[model samples]
Target: MKRKRVVCGFGLGLLLLGTGYVSAQSPNIVIIYADDLGYGEVKALNPERCKLETPAIDSLARDGMVFTDGHSSSAVCTPSRYSMLTGRYSWRSKLQKGVLNPWGENLLNPERITMPELVRTKGYLTAAIGKWHLGWDWQKRDGSYVFDEPVRGGPVDHGYDYYFGPDVPDFPPFAWIENDRLTAMPTENSKPDPRGGRGGPLVPGWDPEAMLSTMAGKAADYFDERASDKNPFFLYFGLTSPHTPIVPSKAWQGKSGMGAYCDFVLETDHTVGQVLQALEKSGLDQNTLVFFSSDNGCSSGPSKSIKLAKELGHYTSGKLRGHKGSNFEGGTRVPFIVRWPGVVPAGSVCDQMVCQIDYMATVADVLGIEMPASAGVDSISFLPLLKEPQAAPPRETLILHNYYGEFALRDGPYKLILAPGNGQGFGGGPSDAEAIQRGDPMVQLYNLGDDVAETTNLANIHPERVQLMTEKLVSSVARGRTTPGKPLRNDAEIDLYKKHLHKGK
Candidate 1:
């Protein structure tokens, strides 16, 4: 296919030189974020190995640009969401460990310049449609439960004009919220959900199976509402499926022969199709810049069913090692596809190492807005890669954080994991005896270009390289931001080296 470098059509105006300014209106932006969807799960990315079929997602790759080496900022949800929206690493903040609990305190600091706020500055209408798991300040009903007092310090406070979704489907009040208040107050207690983790403040007859479809329907409705509006829209549609509460709706029950997990993934794809179809019906597809990606790699399947999934020929992580919460590619690597008719070339593959944190700068570049020194400090725009597939990535050094918030730095193909431990927690990687027998070192290092699976550790083989990367990681942490500008103070002390060394002891 012939590639196009020109950025025109879809109402994008004149690109002024030097000064970040656009003469005309910007395009509509829609980001479809998947929860726990793996790089291998999408058939187009892993054609030879992927077992489950993801036609809707695959179509996005076929019709747009597919990033072969895209990643989330962290291995888990809250941090990933934080970095993606704020364009700064979550480790720079106080959340260095596991995700937030339901109705937990907001992770987004009040002063941060979020992605939505940047887009809104370009005269766009911003809306967060699903899974606002980054945390919220809720009014408590005494000390044990939460009341429906408008959720303060949430998406609305951060940047979004509207917000709707379950706070965290996996760990939740078992209800949906629109803007700040619950769509319907919880009138009954929810039994332990069969899908996965479940908790109280449940609405009467709330069905986990209906959540995805409901969110999809709401998004479609929103599209309909905006069909006639002249202003551009930015929809951050966060899908909460293929994560836990693995309830594949009745329509998708027996779709994927692999298992319930596969079925849920198919349903997730179906929801994507619904949103795309809505855009098409609204005549918005021609001008919309749609991005499809996952929060992180797949987690261990329900009740350790990942082994069963492998037996059924479905490798969720593809050739990558470890699952979510590890320091391996399978933990942070995720599928990223961008579809913008006319502008982004169809069926192009870019192998640059792009991080979700870069979304802020990418949008800023698209809108021709200058990002302040304090904002998006870690973001490096991959916007050039969108126009030219062979363009060099804006970033060279990429950081990966494990579930425990341990750090790893990747420079070129070589990656240096700062501390000793297997990628997966709970001693999940090869047994220590096996690793010792294979001569794995205290700190792990691998050339991901040659060893995508991360099986071989070369820490002891190249001491100088390890020392250099370790120093870089340490400097990045202390500097407060990775991109240029004077260093800022971190919210709290970040000592990932200590955390990784003492973890799983």
Candidate 2:
């Protein structure tokens, strides 16, 4: 597959500058976000433990920079999405735990400065295609759910020029939404799903089988349309596959010898390949900055059971500790790959601590734009590390969030968990009560540099370190913003270390 490369013919001029300033030409930005994808799922990231193949995603790592310590702000999809777009911690909002229901109100306030909104300021076209788990303003006709009526507070309302795909995969109203309107009115109720959440008011022919393929084709079409456009475009392609309902298309079924889950993961990789090929075919590859990452860790759903994965000799979390919905490294740590011709170095690996929330600031840094203090309060630009892999990480302290109240704070290599538990929502982990009854420390601590799997607890031995981290977490919460600035007010009262310990005791 030959690709048309674009050269600005200023290589010598750029070399003379000495400073690594980004080119004045606005580059196309494409973000491919996967749902519930584990760090170990990418073969390049987990060469020794990952049995499933992922050539498309691995190719990005080969041609670009791979961050070994990249993470999402939360262990679930909704909050992570919120943090990625708004550059603020989801915990700062009222949604302290769990994801939003499909019919619920939109959590992304319209007033906030979203990633797309910021990009649009530079006159770029923005589009969001695929699963939008974030809530929207649903329409009702005569007190009954109306499908064709425009839904507010969605992609369009949040700054996307175009919006397409299902609102949520396993949630109600399993039908496609083009812009603010549904393609077809959902008239039939879906059968109850025991393993995954059931869909509501689905259209008669809603098939999970064709969902991913259709979305991929639409994304390809989007690239084709924007190929010759005057302004650079930004496409947020959120993939829903390999998350739940574990339905691998016929072409990918049994492709991976592991199981249905592995097969679905392969299909996801294939989808990424298709999108990349589309960009190349449309002559948009060279001027595009491609980013690939997951919303969170691999889900420990029934279809992707831990026992079954272990039996198949596959470790979804690789050498990390927990799965999705936990505060452990495995739950929040994810695969991050970025490629930009003549900008990012090829085959470079960065061990910098970064989070999805930093996307806004990094984008601003790339464009040489300064963000207001009120926006992206928790975001720190990793742009320097991207240009110089040996440069130290911009962010030194990070806070990890879970659906439960168990929060972990990381300062350099040491991490302090406010509570004791696996931080998972399911599949055989100690409950808070169980940990307390077993004489487990009210708090847990570990040095991730020495123990990536979080096997050792150094809280009892290093009370001073634990106390210091606990105080930092408290100060961060009270200040309402992680980055330097005037302390902002949280949307609601936050649950911090002291409160958690008092309740546990």
Candidate 3:
């Protein structure tokens, strides 16, 4: 694809000068967030272990910088998405545990400034397309949806100018939503899913396999429509693939010999290719800053297990310890790739600690905007690292959480889990009791520099480190913000040692 320069608008030029960073123009930002994609699933990230081929993702990595150490805020979807948009850890919100239930209230506080809202200050058009699991304020009465009314507190209400896609692929109201209303009211109850998805009102003849294709087509259309627009745009292209209802389209059925899961992964790669191709076709690829990452790690849904993929010599979590809902490395650690033509070094790799919460600050820094003190309180801009790959790490510490409110703090290479065991809600290793029975320590610690797999526990060996991290974790929660500013109050009083105390550890 040939590079095309976008002339900087006068307003953007002034903004650039104000922030002391000069650029030709503000680049179009596209975040391609995948659901339940593991760290090693990308062939380029784990060539020796990952069995499946992901040409589109691999090509993306080759065209940009790949971060070997990247993570989501949580090991679950809803919380991760929440943190990604707001730049605040989800634990600070009322939802300190698992995901929001179907027809649940919006997770984002209306007062909060989201990624889209932050970027729009500089006149950027924003659209959020596909799989908004963060939650919605559905109009409901008498224990059912009021389909005629527009959903409130959705993507549009927060920051996006437009929104589309099924709210949750495996959950309720199986139909298409455009903006804040369903394109077609779901008048029929969905058939019992063979893959064990929740039964809910669905559009007539709703085909689960077609969701990804539809999302990709809509995204392509969006790029085409906005190609001639003067303003730079931001698109949050969330994918529902490889998460649930493991229904690969007929064309991709057997493309991967590694069965349904692998096939779905390939289909996901194809969708990514479609989006990139669309960008290229629109001649916007050159000026677009593209990000590719997952909400969490690989999960074993009703369709197939990560174990089956492992049986075929494809380690979804790479060499990490646990899967989707765990606090272990496998759960939150994910494949992160950033591609910004002419700016970021191509085919380069940066092994620095970064979290999804940094998106807000990073975008702010890129656009030369100072973030509000109240918003993106946990975000630390990695813009320096993006400009210079070997720059010192933007953040020295990171906090990780799982579905069950389990906490893990990472300072430098050493990680300290507040509780024993993996703290996984699905297919995890020993439970707290099991770990106790197995003579495990009260807390778990590992030096990731020497043991990325988290094979041996070092809590006993590093008592001072454990105590220091524990205090830091508690202080972080108490302070309610990681980055320096006025100490904010948490929405709820968080008990960091709840799990440990419950298990008498």
Candidate 4:
């Protein structure tokens, strides 16, 4: 049955009413988006692992709702973040494959209304801090390493009142940016090496082993000082530790027996703790909602897991087949934990399937804000689950887009992959049509509820379902563009990505 649409969203009120919430105040929201951490990386989600003790994250799940079936909109970084903020599908734009480079041109358009903008309208201060994978316009020309134009169309432009960090690297332009201006200029600065390795082009800066910790500390300070009667703020504190280059700070070095990758994650968890602490310190605990999730599954190269398994006896994506850059379960399904002090139940777990794309609508639903018709076209609000532990949200299908532009639509237990190849390409170019043709990209169907690892193929067993899924996948393509917030046509840049893709890690 279609849920009755109310003129005024009584959703949040009804949700609070379940617990007899009589307060007139709304909870402050904080979304902690982590880069490249997998579901198994969180100890609370994957308890069998002992090396990566995410005490901060474990406490997060212990105090909130741990959603088992949460997913990024795409199986990659840029697109997923785009969808999460815009509440729309990444395919709504044109550049569907891979992600943006550190110095790439601006991806989001000026007219886009972001989550921060939405919440700020209701009197909340907003900021975005961390790894900005979404494209920002930086000055680069004809193979020039130095920059010309200051980067544009980033967090500040997209509704974040204050922004820190870069479109890429920590190193020349390595200095942080407060809003559109530079926080500190990089002059007479040591030419830091490209920070990310394994999966990287290695931009400069990679300096100050204390970068991650400092960001966390400052963010905690920001929350503590700014979150008061004068400023109820929303902070999108994105962390970049576990992404690549495998640089764990000295304190965390060799801390996790699993390897440098796991150690980096420990710091990531610690950073999450700092944000929560900021809330608690400000006495905003009971009136705040904190969300923790990743851009996608771990951005591990195929060899990293094998090496870790041989040396430390560990698998990054747990038992899920395939890893980052592929259209497999491990590439997308990630850890999602939500904690709203006094509102969300502690020690609870939800297995309902939800995508990061739904974030905008859920927040809007929670705050009694309505989304503009053009935004979040693919979003379904899961606000109901926050109030009632067992109350179910609408059963909605989720679509996962791969670098190759091959698509998969997941409905309930059944998933249909619309491609011509094996859908797993190691080249990082994209599991595109050519790769699929070369690899027998046959249509695949799997019941993920029963086969969470996506090991068995049930396509042949259910031909009718395969046909239905194929139709849906085709429709998604027909309706697809690029991310909605992106510019109309950046053929010059999109083509550049397409040309350089074959040379990727």
Candidate 5:
């Protein structure tokens, strides 16, 4: 372990050169992004309340920093994944709402550079395992998933040396890909998820049951193989479990007693343990930067909504007003746990509002690499905050976007929503009723510091503040960029999204 920890010789020399920018002892970066885990889902975050055990995740938080107000760029998978990888807002692209279908053309533009690409330029073997919700072109000719469609715009095209998992569950050719080649060919084209297996159909050649374990095994293997390797690695392990189909392995079944949803979460927690175990076993734990977070809030399921309501008498979105798919605090706010051994303080909690979108520039900054103007437009380097929670975020105003491009920009205590409809979506029960009074207009405003649930609409009283944030959201949309860095391409991909997206359907 001692030999594995390379001493950092921090010098301007690495920074002066265009490539290897991070410290010589640059830690391997691993981002474990859960699909729909909620803000207060982790037991440590809400010890007195949260029902989910997640000891593995709890141990992870104890090892490093835990963020209270972390959010995904988008509430849903595709958009959120797109924003995380590109460091740009999904609204900047054409896919305005919901998510992409498995059969749809890819969402990422082939020409646009990505985070893995940025890091790879500085000598990192970037690999993305597990679920890839961002769209990818697969299987069009002679049973070949590639099909001359030019798998150019995705992680492979960007910077990752390897790729895996379904282009999302329901998407066609539902199988893992190793460097653009499918591990199992879609001998039969998968159909729109018919009845159940969580969300996607139990398609041929695709056993959703084994996916969680399979992915974890592969990740562990990858880490073991890379332990002795010289070049630092950036691995993005995006898990599909705890997302949908709610199917956990038989051993994990009934363990949660909250039904499939909680069972799947337990399975996800085990997967986290597997990852951390691999790092420790390989002597890579100390030098590896491990981050665990979710793309969005918890999904509305029998466990969290019905079963939990019957038993706990409430939902798992915790104190948040709504669940996944809404702009409410639950939808976008998520758990963010980062572990970097000695660099980050253990058991520390940071209340700063940060998003996965900042990772592009933040990782680059930590690595000491110069981000080309073409990359990381919306990404602010949160490198300083990683080691020091008191350090200010690079950006004062952090934005939260719902599934349908409903925008919420937060500047300190004040948060301004661009549109109406309660910002929680048109729904039933208490939340929607409160929204009715506002009539869903005039750019509702609230002091998140005061009203975390956003119960009071201060729009009438805070007109000037509303106007300012509205303008900011509109201007950001107009610019079609998110980060403050330069556009990766002087000529941004005119075709930001692929045709045949779910919208067309």
Candidate 6:
């Protein structure tokens, strides 16, 4: 593919070039974010050990640049999503622990600029289609949700011109939501699933099995509508498959003989193919920049089914340690592929560190716009890497957090985990309580360059290094933003080593 260089100058505060300037040649951007997908789940990322096939995702790797050291900002869903959109750590927000509750208040502050909102300044039409795990302000009466009125503070309010998908696939009001209103008010309550997930008001005869296909179809329809439009579009296609309530349609049930989770993985790949096919069908493939990644690592199903899958020969996290909700490489390290014809070199691989939070700044660079000082404070543009795969890495250090709010600092190859055990999720590591009782070291350190699996703890061997990294982590949290800028205030007080502070030190 021929390289197309985009030339533009940058200045501070919201498209400083001019208020009327719009890039006539800006490429359409599509971000396909998978839910709970592990690093090795994609066949191309771990061909030797991975059991399942992901042709659509693999094609993205073959067509563009694949980052071996890519990661989500957090080891869980909501925080990672927040960071991806806002270019700031979720820990800086009030949500320090788990995800947003169903029908909870919007986690995004109204004053903050989102990816969609930023792109709108460049005259791009933005749409968020698929699982929006972010909160919604559902009208409630006496603690119960009332769906008669439109919900507030959703994708539309956060910069998206169009929005569709369930607030959460497994959460209440199990029906389709377009823009701010439910497609059909739930007239009945859903029964509890035998697998897991809470039951709540549901649309009558809503088929969980068909959910993935419906989202794909909607995305394809969206592409068809925007194909001929003059202005470029930004589509955040967040997939809901391969997560909880793991339901693979009947056609894909036995496609992967491993199990339901594997089957769902296959179906998720097909969903990617559907979106790609739609883009191609609409004649937008050559001009669209597409990103494919996951929110976090694979979930260890109930009864250690993922462990059983590993025993049977499917290494979800590949050679990495821990699973979802851990500070280990496996939990946050994810499959990241970017495809942009005439820009990103095909079949190129980069081993430099990159995080999802950098998306906001990268998009800003691509559109030839400079973000305000307050926005994308943690984001460093990787646009140079996309243009020149051999360019020096834009980021050298990163802060990783798990579902439990445990902090981990990564500087070069050395990783410092403040907490002892493998933080939450299903990796079967020692729990905080168990580690405390066993008198395990409070701090865990590993050189990823030497210990990708994180099997050996080097904290005792290198106390000085641990102290240095710990101080760096503290400074990062205290300063609010990671990148160079005016220090901002965190929405909540941040204690880097909350529970295991005294024990570890």
lDDT of 4 at 409: 83
Tens digits of per-residue lDDT, candidate 1, 1-505, equal 2333333332254465353334344678999999988888888887767777788888898889888789998888889999999999998888877788766888888988999998887778889988888887876566756655677887889899998888788776788888888888787876677778676768887878988889888888888877767778899999998889889988898888767888988999999999898889888888788999998888875624367455766678888887777778888889988888776778778888898888888888878888888999999888878877777768889998887667889898899886666533531465333444555576889999999988778888999999999888888888989988999999998886753244332
lDDT of 3 by residue, 360-467 (tens): 888888888888899999999887777676678999999998878888999999999877775533636766666876788978999999999999999999899898
Candidate 1 Cα misplacement greater than 4 A, ranges = 1-24, 303-305, 308-310, 423-439, 499-505
Backbone Cα, N, C clashes tallied per candidate? 0, 2, 0, 15, 15, 0
Provide the TM-score for each candidate, comma-separated: 0.93, 0.94, 0.95, 0.84, 0.86, 0.93
Considering only N, C-alpha and C atoms within 3 Å, which residue pairs clash in candidate 6?
A: none
Comparing 1 and 2 by lDDT, which wins? 2
State the lDDT at 292 in candidate 2: 90
lDDT of 2 at 225: 88
lDDT of 2 at 75: 86
lDDT of 2 by residue, 1-505 (tens): 1122221223221231222245667778999999889988889888877888899998898888888889999888899999998999999988887889769888887778898988888788999999888898777789877787788889999989999998777888888999998899899998866536585798888888787889889988998889766578889999987787777889888888777788999999999999999988998898788889998888877436476456876788888887888888888999988898877777777887999899988887766667788888999988777767768679989998876755789999998888766543342256565667677887889999999989888999999999899898889888989999999999988867434433332
TM-score of 6: 0.93
Q: Model 1 compared with the native: what TM-score? A: 0.93
Q: TM-score: which is higher, 3 or 5?
A: 3
Each prediction's Cα lDDT score? Answer: 0.81, 0.82, 0.85, 0.68, 0.70, 0.85
On lDDT, the candidate that comes out on top is 3
Model 2 poorest 10 in a row by lDDT: 1-10
Which order, best to worst by lDDT? 3, 6, 2, 1, 5, 4
Error of 4 at 166 (Å): 3.3
Candidate 5 wrong stretches, greater than 4 Å:
1-22, 139-154, 188-205, 422-441, 482-505
Model 4 misplaced stretches (Cα beyond 4 Å): 1-23, 139-150, 170-172, 187-208, 420-424, 427-441, 476-505
Which residue pairs come into collision in candidate 1?
Answer: none
